[model samples]
Target: MIAYDLMKRLKELGYIKEERDPYWWPKSGSFEVVVGAVLTQNTKWENVEKALENLKNELGSIEPQKIVEMDQKRLAALIKPAGFYNTKAFRIQKLVHNMLDEYGSFEAFQKRPSRSWLLAQKGIGFETADSILNYACYKDFLVVDAYTARILNFLGYELQTYQEIQEFLSDSILENLDRIYELYGQEMPLSQIYARFHGKIVEFCKEHCKGRDQAEKIKELLV
Candidate 1:
């Protein structure tokens, strides 16, 4: 199956560093993950991390209520490293307000983060929504970013839409859960598998297949 093959090839190549065990994304189910999901739009993860650290230093917390109560100017200044600071700060405030008004708290929001609800938010797109779902809420939605699309496209999987790629991955995963269990000697939930898959693709792209020459080198390594 494609899932098994992809996972095996990714493992044999060892693209991700050993430090990120189980997965390579940020710490799951935390406010930091949620903020990072939004902050990382159209920017590098390194920039988002700087913004996160800045926010932590400024407010001592990234919680929803704290974000809501903070002055918009201060919030924007703290997250300036993320780029599009004013817009991102406004979006985060709006997200926090929505959480408080609808779900009462981040804890409650994470309990059942509706995909439609997330998509309806001001700054949320498909990839961002799914990142919040999987990483922040620990939900089963798999994120398909540019890296996922590029690698698959390079490998001759030409999908037209995000839904197409998502469904393809879901189908592959459904057909290969048994193989995952067989290899790991334990049952891996759909969410965990999706998280790890997304993380691995991100790490692999970041480290190995960057530009065309880098991609060719990766192809050689794989062979």
Candidate 2:
């Protein structure tokens, strides 16, 4: 029932449609997904795709061991299009090496129970960690990105802190990991839905909501 209503409103506002079902949804337990999450920070996915392609075509694989062992200068050159190449390359290589050193393999890293520890990694942030958790590890956790905050605040939901936003979105919806994961396959859970939802919101805001205060804009236009 709720999904129906949400979909209806989102569609009316041109946020989603049936054709979006097969739009490159991440498969669980892939090393590429985690690396993509990291590289995707503050950059467009197209650039990330290019970087991944370079790593794969020239380096043979996108595995952590391979990435960690690659020359930093060459890796940076390959991922330069993704922006912040120097720093990101170092971070990516270090992260991959750390995963190997600590967990033996990417699969082993995924199987570990130390989510908090993983989150505490050098290049990992809240959104990045949550992305890795949900997409790579297939764990249930709400990913609070800039779009989530903007859309929520525009919708008259005010969160004072980042943690508050996380709690609100995670609590208001899914109660368990299994249920959350289930939403992705069936109709898109708040976790998965929020990413694309937020993506669409950013698109909408850029096209229509510009120059207007978000709160007033959402109320006047979206509602």
Candidate 3:
């Protein structure tokens, strides 16, 4: 399907209003994107933003070494707003330190690897790993997000697990990587696209899909 057609359907379903969510911030680096993915689980982006800002102020930087070297307690404090601060801090520290110890530097870690290797990291689920690879490393990947899930589920598609969605989308775009890249490029990199896409879905769920009645109607459209 054409990208415009998909966009139109999403807009008509009240999933992608042009005016309500106009901002997009593309990701800059792999480590930074991974940090975000870890911090974002079950939390508001606004809170994540606050925590990230605090981390920057306290650590003097967001580079892997800094994150690895930060005091666990203090680091947890800085990222408290992101929730589950203790676990997140350890996760972030381990990820950063692992990258440094294994690869020696951020540039080394940027090297592309077999998909199996990516799947092996702790807290590195398909989405988080793909976000890091596609956004931070500029690899061609079709990111299946919460919005994608809601829209697909509404269409009577039941992705039993995240892997199922990943595999389906991966297969759908397998022969069309270039086209996928172009469509995704319109939202490019991953950060801005992710922020806008996530924000749009969250807003739509809050406004239109809050109850069973609305949700059922929305799901009917998918059929």
lDDT of 2 by residue, 1-223 (tens): 3223333355567764324332223444588887788888998777888988888898787877778778999999998878999989988888878888888888887876366877778878888887777667656665667766776677767787778987776554544435434534465544455455444554565556556565775667666
- Cα error, residue 154 of model 3, in Å, equals 1.2
Least well predicted 10-residue stretch by lDDT in candidate 2: 16-25
**Candidate closest to the true structure, highest lDDT:** 1
Query: Roughly what TM-score does model 2 have, to 2 decimal places?
Result: 0.78
Which structure among the candidates has the greatest TM-score? 1
For 44-143, candidate 1 gives per-residue lDDT tens digits of: 9889989999988988878888999999999999999999999999999998898789999888888978999989999899998998888788788888
Query: Candidate 1's error at 41, in angstroms?
Result: 0.2
Can you rank all candidates by TM-score, best first?
1, 2, 3
Q: Please write out the lDDT profile of model 3 over residues 1-223, one tens digit for every residue.
A: 3223344344457655535323322254546666887787778777888998898788676888788878999999999999999999998888778777777877777875434566676766777666666556555554566756766676667887777875665565444545545654662443344444444555566565654445577655433
State each model's C-alpha RMSD to the native: 1.7, 4.2, 4.5
Instruction: Report the candidate with higher lDDT, 1 versus 3.
Output: 1
What lDDT does model 3 reach?
A: 0.64
Alpha-carbon shift of residue 80 in model 3 (angstroms): 0.3
